[model samples]
Target: MHSASIVEAYTVTIWEMLAVFVAGISAGTINTIVGSGTLITFPVLLATGLPPVTATVSNALGLVSGSISGAIGYRAELAGQRRRVLRLSLIAAVGGITGAVLLLTLPPTAFETIVPVLVALALVLVVLQPRIARAVQRRRERTGSPAHPDGGPLLLVGLLLASVYGGYFTAAQGIVYIALMGMLINDTLQRLNAVKNVLAAVVNSIAALFFVFVAELDWTAVVLIAVGSAIGGQIGATYGRRLSPSVLRILIVVVGTFAIAQLLFRRFG
Candidate 1:
């Protein structure tokens, strides 16, 4: 390449890297607060020309640090939840591994087809989260029965399924987790959010580890996201609660919509 072409190429590369880093920050913050961070980062990675599977794996791997950071930030709420965390963790791990295996085994075309649907589903879940919370609260008011301390088998099954999704796509996994636990476990939302972070960490870590061995990774993308997400995790932990849920939902919906469009274009356009 000529010197001018080399300079232009280098500039474009730097800008893309910067964009990925910013996406990571946004993703980590959102993941720490409400989940669906992948909706932010995955599209940016895809735009940078990564294949769908590579982008998903790299996003999962990069966000693990953010998950851990968010969990630590919520340690205060986690104080009495040891037994609960432990029980749910094993289930999450199994589901995560299962999902990861499915990702590896499935053909690339299957991923292209499935991911748009998954992103659409996750966007719907994000949009409906407030209603889901209110419904959960109403159920609490109507029922006089005490919550099952262990959340019973139903909770385990729900969490297992959510973890599998997290391991596969991880877009809105935290929303699904909080919804399930809120309905079944009878905890305050903050505490449930804390638990959500821990479980997210578990699922992300397990799936990332699995990918390290079997999947192709864009290591540069991974590093940029990891650093950015770690910072975003701290920001979310410190100030995320003060942010408006409506605003966050709007942002997630917008980004998710863009992602769906991009994926569809890649597949059919």
Candidate 2:
């Protein structure tokens, strides 16, 4: 009887791990393309029976690898943007640390009411992404003057605020980053996107280090996500641009809908 139980336990664990891996792939890809991958992985982790807090921490930490992979895959687009990315990275790191501290210290009760709303908001952002992008494009065309290459204080302040939010809820942060970039700086969207990936990765990387040391972690889940995210990030960075805008919009809607459902039906679902 003992042997049978052990075998069964191992089998179950393997299946759970596989599910996490698949979730990570989807998350990494979606995140690279539209910036709300957490809506995919976070819900999966919760459904796999992890407590909300544990799953959030693990998801945050595990996705760091994916961020790095995605950023690296965008290296071609990152040329000439080194100084800009570096300047913003320190601010993101500090904000990320602050957010991690809050997560560690605050009680679960604090987030219970707010998390669903935040996730819902992220879904809405994903849905409106194309409209938002087009609006920025039109605004730039109307201005006829290139926005500052090095944005002034407004850009710095915006990045700081975005990083703090990322450290907290951490969904759709890329959308905020890109919006700020598109409006405040003169740059191609592709290059701005590459910068967004690296800066967000820095914030997450700093927060993940803290979580690894300070929190109760599930290493098994972390490793599975990391591996899957690495693969997914590369696929997204390479082929994601080739996908039609309509296809991307459909994917975001599907994932975002699932996220809303999961959050609404938390206990029973």
Candidate 3:
């Protein structure tokens, strides 16, 4: 290659690493505080020139550390939930393994085509989460029942399905987990959120292990994201809940809108 080509390649590598690092930071913060970190990181990876499957693989691996940090951050709330966490974790791990297999064996075009829709769907769930929580609360109050409806086997099934989605693309799995838990488990949202963190960590950790052994690896990007996410998770755990809800809502909406537009435009424009 010519000297100019070498210089250009070097510049691109630097920029890509920087972008991935920044995305990892944002993703970690948001994932810990709210959810939907994948929506932030995945598009940035694509814009930085990774192929679809490569971006997905790298993103999953990169977030593993973040998930661990977030879960650890919630350790206080997880004190009494060991059995629940362990049982649900097994289910999530199975779904994650299944999802990873699908990612490698299925057509890449299928996931690419649905990425935007999935992001939008997750954003909608996020945007409406407050209302959903309130509605559940209202029902409990009206019925004079603090006890959760009997989830029985159905709750497990819902979690299994959600884990499949989480394994395939983590985007807003945390939000879904919280929603389901709140509706079915009669627990405090904080405790449910703690549970969500552990379960998500399980899904990400298992999927990441699979990717490490079977899929293409981008060590530079993975390292960048891991460091960035670890730092971001700490920051988020320490101060994230103190942030203004309105400001966070605006950020999620703007970023989600941008992700949707970028996905659609890249496919069509």
Q: How many residue pairs clash in each candidate?
A: 1, 0, 0
Q: What is the C-alpha lDDT of each candidate?
A: 0.82, 0.75, 0.76
lDDT (tens digit, per residue) of candidate 1 on 27-124: 88888887778888988998888988999999999999999998888788788999999999999999998889888886756556866776677667
Better candidate number, 1 or 2, judged by lDDT: 1
Per-residue lDDT tens digits of candidate 3, residues 1-269? 01247779888778778888999998887788667788888888878767878888899999988888888887877888888888888888998888888888877655557767766765675577677768867887998867533344656877787788788878777766765665567566566667887888889889999999998877777888898888777766666545555565556566667667866786777
Off by over 4 Å in 3: 1-4, 109-151, 241-269
Q: List TM-scores for all candidates, in order.
A: 0.81, 0.80, 0.80
The model with the greatest lDDT is 1
Candidate 3 lDDT at 147 equals 52
Task: Tell me how candidate 2 scores on lDDT.
Answer: 0.75
Best by TM-score: 1
Collision pairs in model 1: 36-171
Q: Order the numbered candidates by lDDT, best leading.
A: 1, 3, 2
